[model samples]
Target: MPTVAVPQLSVADLDPATNLDAVTERVAALPDRVDVAVFPEYALTGFVADERACDAALERDGPELDRVRSVAAAHDLAVVAGYLERGAGDDRLYNALAYVAPDSDTTVYRKRHLWAGEADVVTAGDERVVVETPAGSTGLVTCYDLNFVGDSAAFAAERVDALFVAGAWPAAHSENWRLLLRARALDGVRWVVGAGRTGARNVPDAPLTEYAGRSAVVRPDGHVAAALSRGERDLVADLDPAVLAEQREFIPVLEATENDGSTRRNSRPGSRNKNGV
Candidate 1:
C-alpha cells in the first residue's frame, strides 16, 4: 500500500499573507513528509462584493501565485489553495483553486457549481481540472461543487486517485458538508481531502456568515480517516493506494457503470432470461 500524506488547513478572516504563513506553519508541524496541502475557498480573501473582492483578485501569472509556487518549491509538496481570480474582463471574477506543484506551473480550476449568490459574484466554470502527481492524478473542486454528484463522477470516470475540495462552508450546514465529503469519496471510490475556513465574518451592510471549519480527509470506503473540529485549523491523513485498489477490485462499480444506465442484470445468475422467459 502506497501511503500519501496530506493536510487540511482551516483559517478565518482570509488574508493572503497570513493564510500563506499559516500553511507554512502547519506543513512544518507535520511529523512525516507531506505530499500535499489544501486550503479553503477564498483563502486569500473572504467572499465579498465585486469591487472589494476585485481588490484581492489575482491574475494567473501574478505575484500572489508566485508566492504560492515558491511555497511548493520550498517544501517540495503540491499545494492547492483557493482565491478570487480576475477574469478576462473588468469587474469579472472567478472563484478559483490554484494547484501548485513543485517545479511545475500552476493549474487553476474554477468553481463550476455556484452557491446561492455566488453566480452574482463570480462566473461559473465550464470545465474541470485534473493533475498528475506522484501519489496519483488529483482532481479539484470547490464548495458547492460537492452538491453535484456528476462533478465528482466526472473525475471518477477518469479514475483520479484523489479529489481536493476547497470550501468556505457555513456552520449552519456543516453536517451537509461532512456527509457530502464522505459521499463524494465513497461514490467515486477515491481519496478526498476537504479544507474549510473557520471564524465569523460580519462586514458592515453585508450578511454575516459563520464558517464551520470542518476540514477532513476521507477514504474510498466512506470512512473519515482524519478530521478537525468546527474551529480547529489542521487535519492530516494517509491515503493508501492499496486500500483503494482493494475496494475497486472487490466491487468494480466503476467498470460496471461504464456500460451506461441502460444495462440491467438478473437478481440471481439464472433467475431471469434475457427475453423474460
Candidate 2:
C-alpha cells in the first residue's frame, strides 16, 4: 500500500502559469516514493466567474497539463488535478480532472454534474473515466460531481480502488463537503481522497468562492482516515486496500446493501450516526 499526498492549494496570489510552476516544485519536493499527488480543483487556473475566462482555458495537452505530466514523470508519481478545459471545435468549456501518469498519456474526466451557474458556461460530461495505475485503479471527479449519484455509481460499477476528488468546494457548506466525501467513500467501497482549494476566488454576482480545506482521506468504512489543516498546505497518509477489504468483510455493509436494497430492514455493520455519539 502506498500513501497518497493531498495538497490543499492556495491560489490567492498565483496565476495559472505561476501555479503550475509552484505545483511542479511542490510535487518534486515530496517524498520520492509517493504513488500519487492530488491537487485541488482549478489548481492551475483559479475559478472563473464568467464564461470569458473559461474561453481562455487550456487543452488537455496544453502547456498547463504538459507541466503536470513532466513533474509526474520526473517524480515517478501519478498526478491528479482539476482544470478548466476548452473544446477544440466549439466554444464549450468543461470543468475537468486530469490524471497524469509517469510516461503515459494524460486522461481527462470532465465533471459530469454541474454546479449552479456552471451549466451556463460549461457543458456536462456524459461518461466516467477510470485510469489504471501502479498503485490502483483510480477514478476522478470534480467538486459538484461528487454530489451526483450516477457519477460515483458508475465508478462503483467499475470497481475502482480509489476516488480522487478535486474541488473548489466553499466553506459555507462544510457539512455538505464532509458528508458527501463520506457518502462517496461508503458507496464506492473504496478510498475517497479529496483535495480542495483554500482562500477566495472572484466570481461575479456570487459571493467570493472560498474553500474550507477540510480536505481528507476517507476510508471505505466512512471514517476520516487523514486530513490536511483547514487553511492550506500538504498532508500525506498511507492507504491500504487490504484494510478496506478487512473492514468490509468484518461488517459487509456494502454486500448486505447489495443483497437487499432496504436499509431499514438490514442492520448495518459498524454503522454510526453522523454525530459519532
- Give residue 238's error in model 1 in angstroms: 1.1
Note the Cα lDDT for every prediction shown.
Answer: 0.73, 0.74
Taking the tens digit of each residue's C-alpha lDDT, what string does model 2 give over 1-277? 7778987887642267877877887797788768888998878776565645564587776777778878887888888888778876777788777777777456777787788887787788775666665447777778887887766666666666788889788889978988999999988788889897887776555556667888899998889998875766787888886887786677554443332111111012112124220
Model 1 per-residue lDDT tens digits across residues 156-218 = 777777888898888999999999999998888888888877777776667888888888889
* lDDT minimum window of 10 residues, candidate 2: 261-270
TM-score of each: 0.86, 0.86
Error of 2 at 74 (Å): 1.0
- What is the Å distance of residue 63 in model 2 from its true position? 2.0
Model 2 TM-score, all chains together: 0.86
TM-score of 1: 0.86
The reply for model 2, stretches above 4 Å from the true place, is 12-14, 203-206, 251-277
